[model samples]
Target: MPSTHNPGSSSPLTSFGRSIWSRREPFHSIEADHESSEQELELQSFQKLVVDLFHDLSAVSADELLSIAWIRKLLDVFVSCLDEFRVLLLKNKAQVSKPPLDHWADEYLDRSLKALDICNATRDGIEKIRTWHKHLEIVMCALESRKRAFSEGQFRRARKALMDLTLEMLDERDSGSVFSHRNWSFGRNNPRKDARRRQHSSGNSSGHSRSHSWSISNSWSAAKQLQSIANNLIAPRGNEIVATNGLAGSVYTMSSVLTFVLSALVAAIPCQDRALSTHFSIPQQYSWEEQKVEVEQELQELASICENFKNGLDPLERQIRQVFRRIMNCRTEGLEILSRANNLE
Candidate 1:
């Protein structure tokens, strides 16, 4: 403290202190810059994560819907996608209904996933999510086009497709989950009756139940197969994974033929029960009462059957008699009237 000014002021310590202050200022600036850079990177990562999550949410197809809850979720997802899409495109100074993603998406993806590297979980997840996003974009575009078609009265094309879609959607909404919980849930499509009979006759050990993880394309194929069956355009194929209603064209045809044959046989043949002409032999005790009841019931039923079978008989008889009587009356009465008129004249 006594020599505070003199020695210290011009000493090496002073120069050292000045040098340290200069270094400290730059280091502090670097630290601030590094913090800012870290924050920017974090923000970019957050934005990309949001986009991916939304992509997963947005990409729902009709085939993906298996239940009412799923359909509802799909609709909600579609709306959300539309909203976000509109916001994004508008922010980018483009039309909301018609996004310019196609022009930019490839480049963006190429650049974005380049940093992610292949064979990484993040890359795989992002690729799947991106595909879903694109699919959702297509559906969203279709929906908008459908609405425009209605507004413009392109009713024939739009109405047909829309109506079919609505019906399919309803079917999906009303159905249970397509996911199989049990091993036998992977049932085959309709087997030929002959093949099934042979299998039953031979043995029940043809194959084991198969399990398949769901994919977007698999779901779509299953849906299309079901629709084909429903529309009866193609018979249900063997080993169909979904809607194993076992509806086969051959079976349907066989059933129809059998029904026709049975009906024809019934119409062409009469009851040939020989016992119908046999005598009723009974014990004396209950003979009279039972016979009387039985005969009366039989007679009543026979009478009813006969009553319904008038066919052309009653009307034909009436018409014939009516014509004869009219002819005879005309001959007799007409002669009398003519005779009376002649006399009066």
Candidate 2:
């Protein structure tokens, strides 16, 4: 029978623990035993980190699941996992550079590129929400007058704002990407520095110029990008597991987390060609799979929230403010991560 406890919650000695144990030659000496024990502890720490992240996410109440606060928490989880994964990769660089693990790393990096596009699209979606918030502000101003009585002209103005908001949001659904034309991005805010960096990177053998690479074309589709990330994301077989020295599970876990988080964002936020019909086949043996039901419910709730964005001005206005603040916070975190990456290089 499958284990009842959350994958890593019950024991520090998980798959990685067993992998280390079996791989170690007989430790006849006390020093060897101490070293082997240390290895198990390190592996256990990583497993505990993963378990806590999923537990926190699954414990949220329904009302808070898809809200801006929850989204912020989700981003935090991704960043934390990413940092830990990076450390694990570095510590096991020799194994990572080998055949099967190398292939998995390449795929993970490719998925990360796709994630960058999603990040750009999400930023644009935040701007779109800001635009909608402007209309909400107009509606509030038009209706919340301190004058003796509401005038016909005030009602007319309110109606016009509401109509514009509804029509614009509707047009967004038809157009796929409403902010594709805008050249906004998270970093490279300085035009001169950005231009020079693009010029420097243009000569590299990567074949693609940085200037053209960062912008999402009009034809870019979030739904398609998500589908691409989900392609071939399956659990490793027993032989493959042995080849990677049990690191296959870690790679698969990180990839699944990436796909799930990005899919949830696309479902909740306005994106070009947004769709939530993507399917995942998470391995049942993994403890994290237990959280899958909660995740699906949250996505369903988010889809409903997206459809009802225009139903109530007062509530939406509040939501927009919260979203705007959270987006700004997330952007700050992104910049910090970039800075850390640069420093690491």
On lDDT, the leading prediction is 2
| Candidate 2 TM-score, true structure as reference | 0.62
Q: Which residue pairs in candidate 1 collide?
A: 189-239
> Candidate 1 versus the native: TM-score?
0.16
**lDDT per model vs. reference:** 0.28, 0.57
The total of clashing pairs for model 1 equals: 1
**CA shift at 129, candidate 2, in angstroms?**
0.4
Please, what are the lDDT tens digits per residue for candidate 2 over residues 137-225? 67766755455445667667767886787777767776765455654343324355345435423233231111122566677788888
Q: Top model by TM-score, which number?
A: 2
Model 1: lDDT to the true structure: 0.28
| lDDT tens per residue, model 1, 182-229 | 121123222452353343232242321111122222123222322232
Question: What is the TM-score of each predicted model, taking all chains together?
Answer: 0.16, 0.62
Stretches of model 1 off by over 4 angstroms after superposition: 1-65, 94-102, 105-345
